[model samples]
Structures are given as structure tokens and as C-alpha cells.
Target: MKHSGSILIVDDNPDILIAARLLLKQHYQRVKTTDNPFDIAGIINEQRNSDQPIDVILLDMNFSQDSISGKEGFYWLKKIIEQDANIVVLLMTAYGDIQLAVDAIKAGASDFIAKPWQNEQLLGAVAAAFSHAKDKQQVGKLTRQKQGLNQALNTPNFKFLGQSNAMQQVFSTIEKAAQTDANILITGESGTGKELTAHAIHQASMRHNQTFMSLDMGAVAQNLFESELFGHKKGAFTDAKADRIGKFELAQGGSLFLDELGNLPLEHQAKLLAALQNRQVTPIGGSKTIDIDIRLICATNDNLEQAVAEGRFRQDLLYRINTVEIRLPALREHSDDIPLLADYYLNHFAQKYKRNLTITTHDMASLCHYSWPGNVRELAHAIERAVILSEGENLDVSSVVGNITSNANSTNNPIENNNAYDTFDLDILEQRTVRAALTHYQGNVSHAAKALGLTRGAMYRRLEKYGL
Candidate 1:
């Protein structure tokens, strides 16, 4: 089924408002009616507060038969555009004032609708307005992505710096995904360079010159989710001091990187689904709906399938976002890349901390032996710490990675980790280990239980015993 956007009919005449609503009702999910020009602003504010934006405005040009200049309507239209430049405004004009209609267009009217309108013409104009809005949005999204990519590519930190087959495959994947507008879902443990991948994708796209904004979904508040994503009108809420634009609107011609997407609430999932489907957004407390043109790239450590099964996320939304899923291997799974990544980080830290440290064979072995639970992020931090704290030219392996290898060897089997299981004193050490791992990974039972060599469901039952 075709997605129907919301429409607003603004006319002083009740008959005209009724007619417009009836005509638009067939195409739009909602058709708001307002006869008073004075109440138009309030009506818009109401919609914005509700997180529903008015997609297209069918505004009557002339108000009060005594005032045929359309001065009031024109003034409001100008005000509306000043507030939101992307709104689709269709002017309604009486017959024989073709010059006025032309002037309205010049003054920011999207398209003019003649009085005593034909159904086809009105619908055609509305459809054209939607098309125009979408085109404008796409152009804006490209512009932003282009700016972000240019900045990222110009940075000295963008070199992939690897010779491994895994790294080679990642480079190839980045190159392939960059050339298209497909929605990308990147999954891996945190600190696995997902943001770097997103930036690389943006730089590789045709929109490398536009703005690229990244939003951390986990950081946003649940109650403020809609306002942050769609935007809000001034006076829409207590803290909505002015008309606020959402990420979708700001990312108008660029790529929108939604980091930690799995953490978003179900309410937000519905809103996100709507925006991606329609490519438009409404600000909080404001009546005008702005079009958005953005390539979306989402990243998360959480498994969305598990989220769906647990009813924490919507399945349909998952289908929409996972059009092109790229599962990134963790550092442990791709151990062959450790030496390469470590060398890159070592050199980076050595230069940054003004140290002349060199990695010895012993140092390399220590790094390769340890399991990096925190992935590339943990390794980078460890390297920086080592560089800052080391004294001589040769990197200090003992000081840098104290006990990392030793700890791994000792805890290779969860059942053998006497210290970790000491608190529980359980009859089943394996089950207790799985529960502890689940708790540590925050309900990511699969990943948590993986550390203990158990299946997800097995870990789930053990976690249940601990009242998790």
C-alpha cells in the first residue's frame, strides 16, 4: 500500500475547507481543517506538539472578500517559510488573477490552484507539491553528507592501514556500499570502528560534499525522542523555547548516522519508520512539515532479531533498516588483524604522546595473545596508556599489558574461574558463569553466553535463576 502523508487545508470559507478536505481525504491519512487565518498558527502548533507534521498546505490566497490583495495569506506564507524553508505551500487563487498567482509563486508559493478547481488539477498540484518537496529534501540530504565526507576524508586519521584479507574485504565492502543509497545496518561489538565505516561510506558516496551528522540513539531521552527526531514548534512544550529542527531536517542533503539504533524505544521505531518511508519530518510545536533527503546508516551492538523476539523492537522496522546488513567481526574472531591494528594504534600513540617506542616481538605476542573484549577501542586506549607511561624506546610489555594474557589463560574456562564464581557458591558453576556473563553484557545473552560456550537459550534460563 502507498504511504499517505498528512495534509492541512487553510481557508476562511467553511465550504472551501470542506471541499478541500473531501478531495485530499482520498490521498492523505489525515486532512486538518482551519477556517480562521488567525487560528492557522495555533492549529499548526497543535500538530507539531503531537509529533504529527502537516505535510502540505493548501492555503487560500485571498482572505475576507473585502481584502482581495491576499496580503494576509501572503504574509503568513512568508512567515511560515522563514520558520521552515522546506514546507510545501500550494496557493489557492480565484479565477482571472493569473498575474497574482504568478506573483505568489515568486513569493514562495509552491504551485497555484485555480478557483472552482477540477479534482484532477487540485490532486495533480498536491502530488506535484509532494514531488517538489521530496526533490528539495533529497538535494539537502546530499549537501550535508557531502560536507561531512569532505571533512572526514581530508583528516589525517582516515587511512584504513591494513594488509590482512579481512581488512581487504572490509575495504571492498566500504567501496561497494558507498556508491549507493541503500539503508545500511552495521553490527559489531562497540569500538569496532562502526563510525569510521559510516564516515568512509559517506566519503565514498556522490554526496561526499554535504553535511554528515551523527546521532547517538542511546543518548537521547525516551520522552524527548519524537521531538528530537521530527522537531518541535515553539510553545509546543515547556522547554521548546523556539522552533526546533530535528536530525532528519538538519541532515537534509547528507547522511544520517544513527548510532546505537537498537536502543531506541518502540515509539521512536514507529516514528523512524514513518520518516524513512515518507522522507519528511515535522518540527515540534510547529505546523509546517519539512522534507528530508538523507542516506541512513545505522550501527548497533545489539541483535535486532533478539530485540524483536523479546518484543522490545518492531519486526517490520527491522526489515526496513536491514536492507543491507554488514556484520563486523570482533577483534577476537578476526585475530589475524590484531598485529595490523596494533601497529597502527602503536604508531598513532607514539606520535601523539611524543614517544619513540618500538614494538618488540614479545610485545606483539602479548597483544596477540590477549582477548580484546572491548574490541579496537580497548586496544587503542591500552596502547595510548602504554605510550604515555613507558620510559625507553622499546615498548614496555610488562607495564603496558600487565596480566591481560595471564587472565585469559586462567579464565579460558568459566567453570575454572574460581574467583568469579566464589560469590554464588552454586552447585552448577557453568550455569552461574553463563548468568554472570549475561549480566555483564546487559541482556545480550547470546554474546554473554558465548563467553561461557553456551547457547543463548541456555544462558537465558541460568540468568532467570539469578532473577535477571
Candidate 2:
């Protein structure tokens, strides 16, 4: 793909402008030439407003005949940098003024080319300067992406939860797919490590040095889909106060992971599909289409094929994103890995809270045997609570899921009876479990709610329902 950059040449001689334009117009994405030095600032400002600022400049030292002192070039060079300090300026000097060109370099000029230049020399110099300019742009882009990633992840480091056979198969598929730019679709239940799996593929891929941008499709509002994913020009909408770079543009030359892809509204699916099909996207209220080179990775718990059959999703979009599909195994599917995952989280929580805890063989057995409806995430939270509540060095996760407290023999604890729930009454069991969670957490609603895999609002509704 051509680098997303523009170049400008300022030389008083019409012939110089014509020659530079003929050569550079083919190489750069956008090249502008003029015989007036005074137009520099206005052009720069215009380009800035368009969100496609001039990247490099070729300025002639002498606007008049027999004047190669380079005073004019130096004056314009300062003005150009004042407009944008990061801009690269290459000086155009007469053959006899090579020493003057050296002086120009010291005065903030990137490199100098003698008038009546060789084609190779001009192209090479411009290519080098443009590369340096792109590096500068990349640094600024990476800074923005860094801040975004920090806000999104919240946690310091992200790690896989286990080394089970199912996970090994995932790693193997990642190793193969990392070598290609094919679009990937990840299907898995919530907390099944879909994001981390996509991240692992990107880290092992060739574009690892570039940004790994992501968007949660479920969170984006229906009305803001276009502006959020395809960017927008300033004032495109009432809330678009400034020019915005969307997920597609931000993930240029890298990977874009669209989380909860199934939640995307049916009407907006076509827009996303079009961008992926054309490999380019136009911002809202912008006429020019920007070329994209993103390796798309999408994840969702929803069954997209079923959605498509039901007319809730576009089948064409599904085919576009799923060149390769990876379905993460649920915790129940790989129950043997529970011990490793549990131990890892136990040690992690122990260090985090400055608590020493050891899990018994019986506790480990319970962890492996139970059905983890919330997958690995539930296990981590459970371990954290165990570490916090354990008074002894030996860890007791006996109350991890089935109960809330270690008072297994308390006469008031109805569920602890050997014949508890003999009739398999779900309502009675749920009530006992809710009461136990509240009691264990000392009526801490939030903690109890999270322990039961319920949102605080849902917990409140249940509390009112059961009159607790």
C-alpha cells in the first residue's frame, strides 16, 4: 500500500515545478507544486484542515536568475517549520552552491538536491525523508493507541489461563494463521479468552510492532456506528466537534479486533462489509476514500450462522470475516486444566493481597468437578475471595461456588444438610445460595452479586423478588 502522505514543492521557476510534479506525482499519494513561496502557509493550513497535511517540502534556494546565495530558501524553510515543526524540507541548490546546500542542512533542512538533479537522487532523497516523516507520525499514533489500550484493558498484563490440550490446539492454529493476513473470526462464550487469543495471534504476527486496535461493537450506539468505525470530518455531526480517526484508520497496517460482532445492528453490517470488501473507507462528510490494510479479527458469543438464517445478520459479512474461525473451548470441555488455572490465580491473588494460602487436594477436586458457568473469569474472582477470606495458611475454596461461608455445620445453613435439595427444587436452592452469599460477604451487595455472576441491578431485582 502507498504511504498515506502528501508532498509539496515550491520553486519560482515554472520549469522546476513542472519537472518535480512529473516525477513526484507518480510516487507519492498526493503531490502539490507551485511557483510561489508565499502560498506555503495557506496550503499547509488547508491541508491540515483536510486532515492530510503536507509531509515533505522541496524548496528552491534562488527564485531569481544568478542568485544562489540560498537566503530565500532559508527564510521559507523557517516559515515552513513554524507552520509544522515536524515537516521535512529538502533544499534545491544550484550546482556551484553545494557548500551552501551543506549550510542549509545545518539550518533545519532535511537534505539538499542540486538543480538539474538525477532522477534516482531526487527519488531516493524524497523516499528517505518521507520514511522519516512516517516514523514521526507512527510515534504519535502509537502514543494515542497506548493510552487507548490502557483504558480498555485496565489490568496491567494479560495472560492465558491454562496450557490444556484445547489451549494447545488454539496456539497451534494461531501459529499457522499468524503468518498470513487472512481475516479471522473467533467464536467462544464470554470469559473464554477470545480477546487474548486474538492478541496472541497479533503478537506472533509480522505486524506485531504496529497497533492492535479494538472496538466493542455491543457498546457502540446504533446511531454512532459509522463515526465510530469509519471516522468523521469535524462538524460531520452535532457531536463531532473535531476530526476523529475511526477504528479502521487507527488500525492501519495492523490488526482490528471487533468484539461482540454479533451485536452489530443489521443495517450497519452492510457498511462494515463494504469497507472490508473494498479495502478502503471514507470518513463521514469526507469525499476522499482512505485505503485500509487491516487484518480483521472478530469475536462473539452469538451464533452468527443462526443469526444469518434468522435474517438478523448478513451472511456475506460473515463469510468476509471468517476466512479462518477459532472456537475457544469452554471450561467444562477442558476440565482437567482446572488445577493449573486455579493454582495460577491462587498464587496471583496471594501476592496481590499479601496473603499466603495453599489449596487442598479436595479443594482442587471440587474446582475440577464443578461446572464453571462463567468460565475462567469466575475462577479468578473465586480465588481472590478465597485468598481474602482464608484465615489459615491452607486455602479453603470449599465455599467457592456451592456455598458462601465456611460455616458448613451451622444449624442455620439449610443447604449444608446431607439431603439438601433431594427434590431438586431450583427456587429453594437459589434462595439458599443468595442468602449464603449475602451472609458470607456481610451483606456487601456488590461482592455477593459478583460472586453469583449477577450484575448489581439483577441482584437488587432478585432481592426484591424474594423479599430478602
Candidate 3:
């Protein structure tokens, strides 16, 4: 996280390499330059063995001298990923070769900065990439602590299932963003698979082999948030019996997912922004700042923009963390996928509960009509609950709570019916209703406002009111 850290600049052109080194020298204490892509592996190995692995690599994906569709760059990138997947690799490309940049990302490059890049963009990417690497290392440490030193190392390929459009979109975004150091902000209502999205992003990223750390900002106490995120030195405070690495330091070269970010206090947000901003963490009661590299992903049930407007969250911080924003649709929006989700959860819990039951038409009708207030998470829990309590071969709706029905009149679209709110939270129900309108019109605020029977200003006020 230190601005004075080391960077290795690799480019085929002496001019470009020199320029890169000079550009980095402003922030980095030691900037190593190498114009030969062929020598990259040797240089990286030597650095790794010396325990001073280059903190960042400014690499040109195409070498003019040894061009065969970037064979040279590809070889080095593969080798680097194989040697140490935790390295922060920022790929450089010429202006008209964006397709090649995308290919490099798929091949494991951490990020891509084009030729003729702005100084601020390059430095910002470097800083963010380095922080991502440090965070992965920190998460690895936590995984080691939670299980064993070899736990993450021994894990096999991950399994995440969902063919829903939202899930597919989520997967594609993660695939594209994982190779880069871009910060991700996932927004969704409670139970809409935000954590799962975070997990998928990490699993598909270059740091897939490392640890994945997650914590809910809303659940942690304000006083404990600091020590929890940034480790404390031994005897730093009461009950600080031994040294501990916080999540930021523990998730180095991996990912740290902050769930319910809207719940994070302003103080915690400041510290997080600083760690992200400076790429360095000052642990509680520790004078020395630890350099860290981390990929950050934050999820929230509350609307962050409103939080920023209300002065509860930092606007600059939001810009920093939300390079890519993914909004997850609630269960009702994608009701067509309910049967699939329900079947999946049913099979999952049925296996766990040792039940050989199947859902019936009546049960499916009940589920489809029930306006799932809890989204996927709630549905999964309901299925598991039903699985455990079922007494027959066919699962029914009686095991689950809440109203689910069979009549078309009973299943009237909440957006078109006022009666749907009879048994639901008016605030959330209204928000969902308005959000549906916004979606139906592709975010045309005025049209959505008209469809929802409100003025445009009223609609905006509601969004601001609910932080939607």
C-alpha cells in the first residue's frame, strides 16, 4: 500500500519502458525496467525467490519485437499466473487493440491500461491493483486461520448454479471484472444473492486459488469494526493477547467482500476509504502501516446514493468502489425463475434431510403465487424448512409460512393491485412497486413516475427517501 513500493515495468520498446518506469518512479520507490518480454519469467522468479516479488507489473501485452499475435506476452502471462496467481499484473495495450486487451484479461491479466493513458488513470489503476493483491494475501491468512494452512490450496473448482438472466449477467460481469483490479459494488434487496455474486467474482478471477473473506458491516459493532478490518498488534488493547491479521491484511491477493455496506458507520467508511485510497493500513495500536493489495467488493440492501446524499456514506468512496455496479432483481421481478430456484433448493435440502419427496402441482402453484418477499435466500430457507418438517412424499405449502395462493385474482401483480400490500411492509412493497415501473421503462424516470402514479419529483424523492 506504500507509494514507495517496488514496480517492474516490462515493455518491448525502450522508450515505452523508460516512460513507464519514469511514470511509476513518481510514486514507487524502486521502478525496475525490462524491455525484453523473454526475460520476464526469469526476473519474476528471481524476485519471488528473493521474497521481494515485484509489487506491481506494468506489462505491455503486445511486444513489437517478437510479434506472433502476442505469443511472447501470452507465454509470460501464463507462466506468471502459474508461478504466482497472486501477482498484480496491469496489462498495457495500444489504443486500437481493445479486443486484445479483453483477451489478455481472459488470460489472467490483472488490468489493462492503454497506450497514451492519462497519468492519473495509470497511477490509480496501479494503486488499486496493489491494494487488491494485498487484500488477497490477507484473505489467504484468514482462510489459513479458519481451516488450516492448506485449506484453500486444497479446495477444488467451485460450483455456483443459476441460469436466470440476472445470474448469467452477474457471471459475465464477474468474468470480465475479475481479471482487472476494478472495484465492484453489488446492489440488491436482502436475500437476492449478493454474497453469492461476490463469491462467483472471486472464484472466476485470477485470485481464484486464494482465500475469500466476507463480513457484514451491519452486524459488526462500531467499536470493533476497526480492529476487525485492520489487525491489531499484540497487547494493542484489552483482550489483544496475540497479534492478529485483520481482514484487509488477511485477504491479500484475494477478495474481501463487505456486505450491507450502508450499515458501515461514517468512521469505518473513512478508514476503509483510506486503506483503499492509500493502499496501506494502520492497524489499531500499531504505528507501522502494512502495505496491502486487495480486490474489494461491497454489497448493500440500502440505496448507497441516498446514504451519500444524507451524509451517512461518502460520495467519493462510492465512486472509488463502484467502478461497476450490478443491481440484482428481486424474486418477484424474475418470477419465471422461481420453479428452478425452488427445485434447486428442494434437491439441496432433500439430500441433506434424507427425504425423497417431490413438489406437487398444488405446491408449485402456491409458491408461484406467493410474492416471495425474501427473494432467493428466503425461498431456500423455506424449502429447507419444509424439507425438514414434511411428513409425506409430496411437499405442500402448509409447511411454509406466509400467504401463497391458487386463484389468479389472488396473484394480482403488486404493481397493479393495492391489496397486495395488505400483508407486507408498506415501505418495501411500495419501493418494489416503483422499482418495477422504473425497470419496465428501462429507467425512464418520467415514464416510470407516470406509470406509478407519481410526479417525477415525487419519484425522485421516494428513491432518495428509501435510498433505493
TM-score of each: 0.59, 0.61, 0.57
Tens-place lDDT per residue, model 3, 122-194, is: 8899999889888877886776675553245334222355677867777787788888878999987666788
Clashing pairs in 2: 358-395
Which candidate has the top score in TM-score?
Answer: 2
- Root-mean-square deviation (CA) per prediction: 17.5, 13.8, 18.0
Which parts of model 3 have CA positions greater than 4 angstroms off?
A: 1-159, 402-468
Candidate with more favorable, higher TM-score: 1 or 3 = 1
Compared with the true structure, model 2 gives a TM-score of: 0.61
lDDT (0-100) at residue 188 of candidate 1? 78
lDDT, residue 245, candidate 1: 79
Tens digits of per-residue lDDT, candidate 2, 291-366, equal: 9998899998777898899998999999999999998987878988889988888888889999888898877877
lDDT of 1 by residue, 241-299 (tens): 88777888877787889988988888889989998888887776666678889999999
Most accurate candidate by lDDT: 2
Instruction: Supply candidate 1's per-residue lDDT for 7.
Output: 79
**What's the lDDT for all of these models?**
0.75, 0.81, 0.76
lDDT of 1: 0.75
